[model samples]
Target: MAYEGKGVWCVGEVRHGDLSPSLFELITAGRIIADARSETLTAVLIGKGVAAKADEVAARGADKILVLEHDALDQLVDEAHTGALTAAAGTEKPRTLLFSASVYGRSVAPRVAVALGGAVASDASALTVTDGKLTLERSAFGSAVISTVAVNAADGPEVVTTAPMAFERSGTSETKAEVTQAAVDPASWTQNTEFVSFSADESKEIDLGGAEKIVSGGRGLGNADNFSLIRDLAKSLGAAVGASRAVVDSGWIPYKHQVGLTGRQVRPRLYVACGISGQIQHLAGMKSSDVIVAINTDADCPMMKLATYSVKGDLTQIIPAIVSEIDKVRGSSNGS
Candidate 1:
């Protein structure tokens, strides 16, 4: 298969006036495909005031950097991002475009693909280039199986949105990259969407993706009110709250708190599962945690088997006790 055009592009995301941590993971993924095809790797930073961060991306070994800046990009407007990316891709003509399967990426990848007459695959897990053919792997049926798909470069470029944490960020050498600023005029960019007031969940001020510790709940919690036990335990340990898909689907919590194959992939230092049966789908997301504690009545559940410490009992009874013990330790330290 003759690869079309040249270079592999990673569409990076920015947050809080700097680059997002997920950009490093995309770099790791892009590098693999770039090395396999013996092509140069470029990182595209598109946002307001993201020029300063291009140097850091270049330092991380990107061969080139394209910074598309516009005032309209101050917030994540799908049309504005889609237009900026489409213009950038039109000029650079990268064969493969990679994006993190995040809120921003999910909205932009397909739109860019449509504008460029390319193929797109979302929620992609693994990537491999075989004989210059780019192949992306997507999990099927709750991650119980994986499907491999090859994109035909002859038709157009391949635009891919990868699952967060699906690719690990490894160490990279400091290398310089040629940075180019593409000022996409606002007039050219489309904007049918209006900016609304942004309301954040105060309870989730601690980001689940970056949280060191997480306490997750499942349907076994019995009712939505029981989720407070999970929240209390998480608060006691100064950890973020997570939930299984079953509970999130049941409206016990928001989708942002879901940790599973089809949800957020997290690698916390400590992961405590309460009243969770630990399906394979749930394990697929947090199995990489350094420590796993499973609390369930049935000790033979998959989560219990995978946990570093398994407690066979009722989580309603167990969670409060753990929280109480932590409180006692904290109190003793405070008194000391």
Candidate 2:
């Protein structure tokens, strides 16, 4: 649609005292769209004390930065965030808005859209400006089907939230963006929610989304006690531990370790699947991994077929042998 307003706006997110990893991803995606639409790219940061973070967004490639801060916005209470975003949109008059597909983005996009009388595209994996229209590709039916939708300029301002890891994060740029302090009065907005406190995930493992390497186990591990094999291998490889849905539901592992359509989506440089059958749901979450290694006795399994390297064997023996080999390699390097 004709943003006839000004630039493409990227709504960035801050979580746990720092900018979320997805913020740079938004900038990378938003820059391309802004260029295609012949508009500037602006990053919007709304949070108390977020004004000091504008430089980070600028370093990531935003041509301009808009900061909206208030005591009420110290955390992402929907009422304050939605109100601040809507107010920013009015001031910026951007033709398009992009947000990270996090808890923050998914919640705020629709509310902001309704407030602006605009159409919203949620959890879109890709964004493109074509033939004077904005198009978004989104996954549907538990990620079994991909559907595309386009919005014309006349349909009102475009609002969108991007799926995580859909676009690669941008590297730091040499250019700096001009920061604009956008005015927002959160006191006037209706307050229906309160942020009591931030609870951190107690899991000691590296977060699946950001892990460089992952070793995921499945039901073939036999019992919860046997999961030690998986843990040993993961420890040797210095990788995060993940599990298929079956093991997670069987009480062999916690829900946080589950990796599937219903669980967290991960993109790691190397993903090792032990005993996993590579069901469609599981594949949806990890097929994007740079390299996949599957170990299973059933050579005909889907995981084996999709794996970059397949090992057909007993998991107990295979995992121990792998770990021992790793120890040998490290020991040799240490000259002990």
Candidate 3:
């Protein structure tokens, strides 16, 4: 079987007429695969007025930028975006396709894969090309185990959705690629679905998914009112606030702050678990963090076992001390 399209392609996500941060990360990952295979790294941008953002993707290591602009794609209707992507894939026939593991990418990638007769790997934390075969590593069994899946190049293009923060954004390239406009007829494609208005849920000041540092509370915080300590520590650290399912269930925090298998998956650079017992369910969501610090009264708790640093004490006493120390350090630094 002969493959027509000869490179790795990334499906970029655009929001508010700009490229999403995850798109840069995907470009980095795609560059790796493209380099391994000695192929071009292309990015497919689908949205109205998205052509202007092609230089951003090109600078971030996209060798070729394919723009699929349409009025229907402006608001991200699953069907419309999927149709445009499917059309692009059929024309390009890239060796591998990459998407962000965001809500939009997760929703559209699988559909495009099915339409193009390809296999899809979702929520991949790591991607590589070994012996010219694409491999994806992702959490499985409620994130208790990591499973690696390999896609054969002999098969069509491999579709992959990468988890946020799994890879750093690619550095700017001195060389740039010219953006090409791809033709996509929305009318020819079945318009079974129509996009309506979108309403964002009440979100935290910091987005948990993309947060580099997080300070999470749990049932061990003792009460809803005591959660202020968690908030204070998070604020001091300039980190997002997270909560275990137990805390959310107990109404100590909103569901948006919940971090677990049933909640949002986070891959922060630093994770501070205060008053959390470190249940497997909660660990499932954050075990991918680069560094974990656990403060719990029980030394034998699971969080302590998994943490890089474990502080054994009462959180109420420990957290305040941490805050004071941070403030003192900042004050001294500012005074100087």
Candidate 4:
């Protein structure tokens, strides 16, 4: 195939040897943008065994999968991957480039854009492509405001890394697509990093990144010991544990478990806030959830006002009761 301007190019990612679902989700959203601009959606699949990965890329409605396979490209050496992807961008010259706002993508996408002398919009919640220009929306300034950015670089394609939980996959396997293989090389690079074995926290092995249900607590939980109620409720509901700014600041919870402007953003199917007063900064991260349930003794709190389901009661009394009810239900079901 000739080097031509296509619709959009997404640098596909694989975590722990599996393709990230966020890639497919972006492709689903990209298709609509590309169609609106009358173009085809192409994807760059980089890593070992690129050919084997092409089938799934095609299945996900990618019009073209540019496969770059080489041992040097096995693990992301930032330098090599950036060079290879920048070369692919030159060859494909896509109108737009999409990437996940994942740690890996966030690290590399900006580098690639810089190498190409292109502008980038990082952590976008929504994207629109029209007349070869892209508009991206993202939360900004401690989530107190939303900013819409437009990128029209004279040098290269518009690059975008989407925020977590902004879009979902839409296309089926029937979408027409074709796959092609390509090779890219780096000019020069130095590899000095040594691989080291590190273990995950057994307690937090279940990541909250893509959780479907989330329950959070705030300073209203009273003290560090009282935070256990939040964890118990989350476990009973098979949900992830989160904390508000006040809770995190009070050292009741770690910063990683925090959900707010400076912390993680979650758009779960169900969000339950216990003892949290919905500050604007805190609400920015989770207000987009499909269902919001707030439990607070203060019935007039901001969170209670915004909650789809509000329960005016003491969390100390409510949480144990909920746990007991769940235990009883499970016990009865198991004939215990």
lDDT of 2: 0.84
Once fitted onto the true fold, the runs of candidate 4 whose alpha carbons sit more than 4 angstroms away are 1-4, 48-56, 175-177, 184-201, 323-336
Clashing pairs in model 3, backbone N/Cα/C closer than 3 A? none
| Between candidates 1 and 3, the lDDT winner | 3
- Candidate that scores best on lDDT: 3
Best by TM-score: 3
Q: Estimate the TM-score for candidate 1.
A: 0.82
Which digits, one per residue and each the tens of the lDDT, describe model 4 over residues 1-336? 322355788778865366767777678667767888888788778877666777777767777777877677777667777777887777667767888887777878898888777778888878776675678788777666789898767766677888766777645677656777776664444445433444556685345666779989987788899999998999998999999989898999788889987788887889999999899889988888989999999999999999999999989999899899999999999995
Tens-digit per-residue lDDT, 1-336, candidate 2: 443566888887877567787878888888778998779998888888999898667778888998888877888899899998888787768888888777788899889888877888887778877776788898877676889988654545788888777787889989899998888897657888878887887866776766778999998788888899988988998899999999999999889888889998777889999999988999988887889999999999999998999999999999999998999999999996
The stretch of ten residues in a row with the least summed lDDT in candidate 2 is 1-10
lDDT of 1: 0.84
Candidate 1 lDDT over residue span 76-107, tens digit each: 88998898888877787899899988888888
lDDT tens digits by residue: candidate 3, 1-336: 555557888888887675787888888888888999899888888899999887677777788889999888898888899888888778777878899888988899888888877788888888888888778898889788889888764546688899999989778888887789999798757767766676765653687987899999987888999999998999999999999998899887789899989999999999999988988889889998999999999999999998999999999999999999999999999999
Give all TM-scores, in the order shown. Answer: 0.82, 0.89, 0.92, 0.84
